[model samples]
Target: MEYVASLAFAKEKDQQDPLNKFREHFYFPQRNGKDAIYLCGNSLGLQPKNVKAAIEQELTDWQQCAVEGYWAAKNPWLYYQQYCSKPLGAILGASQQELTVMNTLTVNLHLMMLSFYRPNKQRFKVLMEAGAFPSDQYAVETQVKFHGFDPESAIIEVSPRPGEHLIRLEDILEIITKESDSLALVLFGGINYYTGQFFDIPAITAAAHKAGAYAGFDLAHVAGNIPVELHNWEVDFAVWCSYKYLNGGPGAVGGAFVHEKHASNRDFVRLGGWWGNEESARFKMEKGFVPKKEAEGWQQSTAQVFNMVSLKASLELFEAAGIGALRSKSEGVTNYLEFLLQQLNGINFQIITPKNCNERGAQLSLLFLDKGKEIHQRMTDAGIIVDWREPGVIRVSPAPLYNSYQDVFHFYEIIANIASNA
Candidate 1:
């Protein structure tokens, strides 16, 4: 496809897009009385137009049905998690039986680690990417300490080579091999938050299996941004937040996946709650904890009906758009963004994200030589919503759901303007 940097060309592309109608489903932030170009879906997504109605329905159910709303509401608050299953299954590439909507990402991470990160004396080390999100770092650190192991010794971080932003696949595989003897678990973010590099899940999973270790991922950035086959990849477990690419509202309910082999195993050890008990037995309130014979078995509490309603509203859009189609459009638009950024001659910055579309999602991380914050502020002032990280990187995420080709062009225009002024 020939790329053009003009606004007219952008409008042409958007005009021809089948998913273009999706942009209307979200309510973008207003700036100067106009819709702002929101590219911050990698942080918090723009709210879906249906969210208000979704919340209201729940409120109505609570008012009309009171305690009986669990069974009486239109959505049945007792089974609210079920409403999200089909769409989340498609987005995360796992079967409904292998998936569950639950607590936030880090809490789910801790639960999965407790179930899968069993570190014995001979094989007690956990391998993860260096510079993972702080929550993951903190969770792994505390989990190691809770298990009475020195974090410095029990946690092994694989870092990129000197002066490189991306962690190479070979390096990850090599480290797993080198630490095979003592490695108990291999955990990574499906896509690194800072670099936006999409890690090779199948390859990593195979390597961990070959090394006799369990493989897992925090799919905070990967779940809705790209297609993944967690079950096919034989990923032992995975977790994600809904607010990012999933377009759930702020602090939306999180999701988790457990491979069928483990999800169906009646004896799989996990912290259990009444909601996870067999439905038939739940009302009995007995002593024995018999978990559901699937991913819901990991649930530790009743569904957060209000916390999950927004995600339920958002998933309807995903079901209509399809993750596969979204990924296809993502590759094309993200490529256009890269092409336009490359045409900028005035900026002293390098794209730190992997160049290959297959190795990344919808984000581009601009590593500026200087004035990173200044340029980020310039973009904000120009009504282009993007994110900035420390150490000179600004994250521009063009979410395929709501962002248009025009949005990319305008983002390029703002950056080019900033560069020209400098």
Candidate 2:
């Protein structure tokens, strides 16, 4: 993975990249009638070229079949979610019975909490990383309050030591041991949005289990960006949104997972819905809920056909490329970004993301001590699209599916010129 800070070198890497042709699969934003250098896939992914055709097919089905589209449509809307299970199961490292597509992230988080976060006199607190995505913080806080506990006291957050940028593995494990008596659940984002740190799910799950607590993850940043073994990790449950690395279009359908051990436990305390019932009994319009024996039991309602078609289209590309193939490309491109950024002598910034490839995904958070926001605007003006976060960070991600080494090199060139001027 030797990298050179030259356009020809960048192009050469792109030329050799087996996944480089995937750039054509996405629609990039236009700048002066040309495709912009898009490094913001960690925010909102580029649209798949096949999305329109996929949606149009559904549109045609709805028009021709009307209400009968549920059964008569090409994909059969009644069981539309089944279409995604094969690919998604591979990405999450779970069996088909252990995972299912469902509602938005926070909604699914609340649902998982309902079933997995049951607490008692000796164990009622929840342990999570500090600086998690705000929605997670809110979900955990409200869930604690729902069970009649004060959030401040009921929630334990592990933070980095002073002057440190990332949480240490030992600290997390030690805190789990120290708080084992009170911890009812251990929840975390698979990858921290701001720091772009990929937590060790296997280690985290083992610690939580040893502490006599259930473990879950919000995988919004982890799903398609890196490889995981959720079933092998024995995580109790997990949830994720599909828009970011999954490239499922904005506000796409979300996914949820539970271990197979819990999938058949009809007595589990889950918030049930009509669609979640056994399919044979579902149409009987019965009075009581008889849940399905699989992850489908957690479903609340019918699939959102329109919302899922885009994801279906995206998943096809993922299946063809394979998660392992994508991860290899992701590492190469992200390393190229780090290499170029390091060559900049005085950029008034430091990369806060973990330097180890396994410790991160596709993103690099450039923490600028000064003019971070202004530099972000400059990046935009220069037709380089990246995300900006509070305080002073420019989050750049060269998504392997649609971004190239040239994209990272160009970002470095623009920021370098801006830094020199300052």
Candidate 3:
């Protein structure tokens, strides 16, 4: 698809977009009294128009039904996970029995590690990418320490070649083979936050299994941006936060996936809570912890219904739009963005994201050679809401659900103007 550098072309694309109606369902932020082009869904998504009503419904249940609301609410608070799992499972490519909404992203990461990262003296090392999200780095560091191993010795970081920004798949597979004797787990971010490279999950999972190690992923960047088959790939476990691409409000409830093979193992070692106990036995309040034979068995507390309401509301939109259709729109719009950016002159930057659409999602990470912070500020002030990371990378994500080709064109226009002045 050839991209034109004019606003008319962008508007024409938006007019023809089958997903255009979705843009109206969200409330964008205001800058200079107009809806800002919101390109920061990679950070925090814009609020869905229905979220307020969704929260109000819960509040009304609390007021009218009191504690009975757990059983009587429109969406039974007692079974909130089911409401979330149905739609979320579709986007994540898993069965409802294999997924659950629970604690935040890092907390779920810790729980998955505790259950899966059993290490013997011979095979105690954890293999991961060099620059994972900081939370993952910290969690893995502490988990290895808790098990009485030196992090430097127990953690194998697969780095990119010195001059390259992305890690090579061959290098990761080769390291898994070389360190197979001591490797206990292969954990990775589905898409690296900084570089926006979508790793090959199925290949990585197979390699880890062949090496006699468990494979897991933190899918915070991948979950709603792209469709993934966690079950088909036979990923042992995966975790994600909902606020980014899922369009749940800030700090929304997080989700987790445990393959049927692992979720069905009631004897799996994990921190037990009443919510995780078998429903029939839960009211008895007995001593023995008979866990459910599903992913909900990992729950450590009662459902945070208020926190989860936003995600449930957002999933309605996902159910309507479908993740496959969203990905198709994403590839086209993101490609248009790339094309427009390349047409810009005098900008001292390089797109660090993988060029292949299959190797990325809706994001493009621009690594600037100079005054990156200043340029980012200019973008924000001009009502273009992209995010900047340290070491000079600005993340521009046009979420297919709400953002438009016009949004992308406006972003390109701002950058081109900034380049001209610089």
Alpha-carbon shift of residue 46 in model 2 (angstroms): 0.5
Model 3 agreement with the true structure over 1-422: per-residue lDDT tens digits: 77889999999999999999999999999999999989999999889999999999999999999989989988888899789989988899999999999989999999999999999899999999999999999999999999999998999999999889999999999999999999999999999999999999999999999999999999999989999999999999999999999987889899999999989999888879999899999989899998889999999899999889999999999999999999999999999999999998887899999999989999999999898999999988888888989889999999999999999998898889999998
Ten-residue region with minimum lDDT total, candidate 1: 85-94
Candidate 1 vs candidate 2: which has greater lDDT? 1
lDDT of 2: 0.91
Backbone clashes for every candidate come to: 0, 0, 0
CA error at residue 420 for candidate 3, angstroms? 1.1
* lDDT value, residue 243 of candidate 2: 95
Model 2 residue 170 CA deviation (Å) reads: 0.5
C-alpha TM-score for every candidate: 0.99, 0.99, 0.99
The candidate 2 region of ten consecutive residues with least summed lDDT is 339-348
Candidate numbers sorted by lDDT from highest down:
3, 1, 2
lDDT of each: 0.93, 0.91, 0.94
- Candidate 3 segments exceeding 4 Å error: none
lDDT of 2 by residue, 16-100 (tens): 8888898888899998688898998998889999999999999999999999999999999998988877689889999999989
Top-lDDT structure, candidate number: 3
